[model samples]
Target: MNCEEATKLLDGYLDGELDPITSQQIEQHLRDCRT
Candidate 1:
């Protein structure tokens, strides 16, 4: 995922509102990205 998408989803991630697959993707994205 790109920065924009990840940023948009960050609130959901923090709130635990996203699905497992999407959360995993976001986690992986965070791991790959310096942000």
Candidate 2:
């Protein structure tokens, strides 16, 4: 996911509301992304 999408999902992710696939995507993005 891009920064915008990831930003929007942050709350859900922190609250454990996102599905595994989405969580994985976010995690991957965070790992590979550089500002």
**Candidate achieving the largest TM-score:** 2
lDDT (10s digit) by residue, model 1, range 1-35 = 98899999999999999999999999999999976
lDDT of 2: 0.95
| lDDT string, candidate 2, 1-35, tens digits | 89999999999999999999999999998999896
Off by over 4 Å in 2: none
TM-score of each: 0.88, 0.92
Q: What is the alpha-carbon RMSD of candidate 1 to the true structure?
A: 1.1
Name the regions of candidate 1 deviating beyond 4 angstroms. none
Q: Rate the local accuracy (lDDT) of all candidates.
A: 0.95, 0.95
| TM-score (C-alpha, index-matched) for candidate 1 | 0.88
Displacement of residue 28 (Cα, Å) in model 1 is: 0.4
